[model samples]
Target: MTPILLIEQVLNGLQSGIMLFLMAAGLTLIFGVMGLINLAHGSLYMIGAFAAAAVAGWTGSFTLALAAALAAAALAGCIIEMVVIRRLYDRDHLDQVLATFALILIFSEGTRWLFGSFPLYLDVPAALSGPVRLPGGILYPSYRLLIIVIGLLIAIGLFQLIARTRIGIQIRAGESDREMIGALGVDISRLYTIVFALGAALAGLAGALVGAIQSVQVGMGEPVLILAFVVIVIGGIGSIKGALVGALLVGLTDTLGGVLLPLFFGLFMDPSSATTIGSALASMSIYILMALVLLFRPTGLYGRA
Candidate 1:
């Protein structure tokens, strides 16, 4: 209702969208270039959170925790790519899906066993722990603001890497014609591994950054993973630009719908019924957006036909 509240919600949406973009960016890249449906991607997210929490606990420093998380997730991704995902490239999507699903089970249970089903807590670094006053005198969490800044920076960096760098050129080429790149001595196999690991690291970073605000627990990445899928689907597969737009759209839709839908319904319906029904519909809003996007552009807003 209030302008400040509305601004706060927008910030929330932006934060959520950025995180979704981080997850979706890698997902789209993997699907576009490698043609693998990695259901285990969420598992890498969880691994990163756990790794960060564990390292932070041991070292009492968020920086070390983040470093450990990124490295661990990236390393894990490389191993998975080399040992498990490599065989699936030549196989069907169903096979890749099933294998990755199994990987989720292994990762979840392994983490539970190691961490003993207890959730770990990550603290925002002391420097980033407070609130910053924004224009119009609204205060926002520094950590959340940091997330937005980091996400945008990463987005820019990714754009530059893909558009300006040699590796980006190779990645584009590989996406268009893997065989041609292989023939050109691009080391397609190694590239695939590096891409997977890079994606894993991004997801890991998302988990670590988000873990500071939420509990570091098992299966935390699943919901975000689903949302990330929706984001990429709406944005268009294999398009980073699409992923960024789609993620923001989803974030704003989900956040605003959750807050505003119930209010709108309460005007005409009983308050209790409006709250329940509105909540349900709000949760479904992004999927409906996805459906509409698919209706008009099945490949996504930025995805190539």
Candidate 2:
């Protein structure tokens, strides 16, 4: 591949990493603070996308769509928490898993019922629809660059929120000891709702942002949700730092492997055969990385020592 193509793929990988970070950050927080394994977290992402699409269709404005998406997702999360998820909190992981899985089904069918099976489309805003030239005369999509910027900003905002704020301290405390926090009059239940809502909002934002590039439809978040799981697994159960590193690792590994492995294999085999073999390996690259990380640091890179 040409240097320009390679550079483009690198940028693509970074964008993908940022997207994964958006989803995984919330997943890690939910797991860390609530100790709840929400399989339907991806559904929240879907909700965000659909909400954005509907609003954008109505208003013809991307910014308004995004705002509606965040609000809708946050509101949906709070409602779900109050009505269904709260009960699952005191239950076992198996119960939480089952309940959330049911949520996925409900969300998928509900979306289909509302929007039909046809996928909705989101256009890149006019301001970011073009490409910018790089130093090497390579052009890159402005939208992808925007994704990276937004992702980094969210990461910084998250770090500040969790590390420096009072709510962050309460969340960390809740993670460490729920009962003790309640005993100290922290209103652990309310805190749990807030944390869950935040996670859901992040997931929603990711979905809406990505919907502009991909088709928005039922079950759209499932694939990314699985990748986000891999991210959390590699990052650790409850560590934000781990999620960031692990997401970037997975994103870059997956992207580079898909591109470079074929080239590497082509050196020794026919192009077709090389592509076949390379594709399989590329798909497995993140899993291999996950395994290697686990073998060395079972808890993940930024997990507790």
Candidate 3:
């Protein structure tokens, strides 16, 4: 591939990585603070996308759509936490998994019932619809570039919120000892609701941003959710820094493997065979990386013992 193509692919990978970070960050935070394994987090993501699409269809404003997305997802999260998740806080992982899986079905059917089965389309804002010229004659989609910037900003904001704020202090303390925090008069239940809502809002924002590029429809969040799991696992569960690092690694590995592996194989084999083999290998690259990481560091790159 040409240098320009390589640069574009790298940008594409970075965009994907940042988006994954958005999903994984919330997942890790919830897991760390609540000790809850939430298989339904992806449902919140789907809720965000659907909410954004529906609102955008009505108002024709991306900003309003995003606001709706955040509000809907956060509200959904709060309700779920209050109604269902709170009850499961002390349950086994299997129970949490089964409960959340049922939620996925509920969310999918509920969404279809509300929006119909047809996928909704979201238009990139007029200001972000086209490509922009970059240094070294590279051109990239403005919307995708915007995603990278927004994702980075969110990352910074999350770091500051966790490290520099009172709420962050409570979160860190709760992660260390929930009973202690509760005994100290911190309303642990309320804190749990806030954290869950915060996580849902992040997922919603990711879904809204990505919906502009991909079709918005039922079950759209599952694939991204799986990748988010991989990201958190590779980065170390409950570590935001690990989530960011793992996401970038997986994104680049997946993007570049698809492009470069085929070229390498073509040098030694027929084009068709090379392409097939390369594609298969590319699909497994992230898993292989995960395995290697686990072989040496079972908990993940930054996971605690």
The TM-scores of all predictions, comma-separated, are 0.98, 0.98, 0.98
Tell me the spans in candidate 3 whose CA falls farther than 4 Å from its real position: none
lDDT for each residue of candidate 3 in 9-109, tens digit (9 for 90 to 100): 99999999999999999999999999998888899999999999999989999999999999999999999999999999999999999999999999999
Q: lDDT of all predictions, in order shown?
A: 0.93, 0.92, 0.94
* Deviation (Å) of 104 in candidate 3: 0.5
Model 2: residues >4 Å from true position, as ranges? none
Q: Return whichever of 1 and 2 wins on lDDT.
A: 1
- Prediction 2 TM-score vs. true: 0.98
Residue 305, candidate 3: C-alpha displacement in angstroms: 0.6
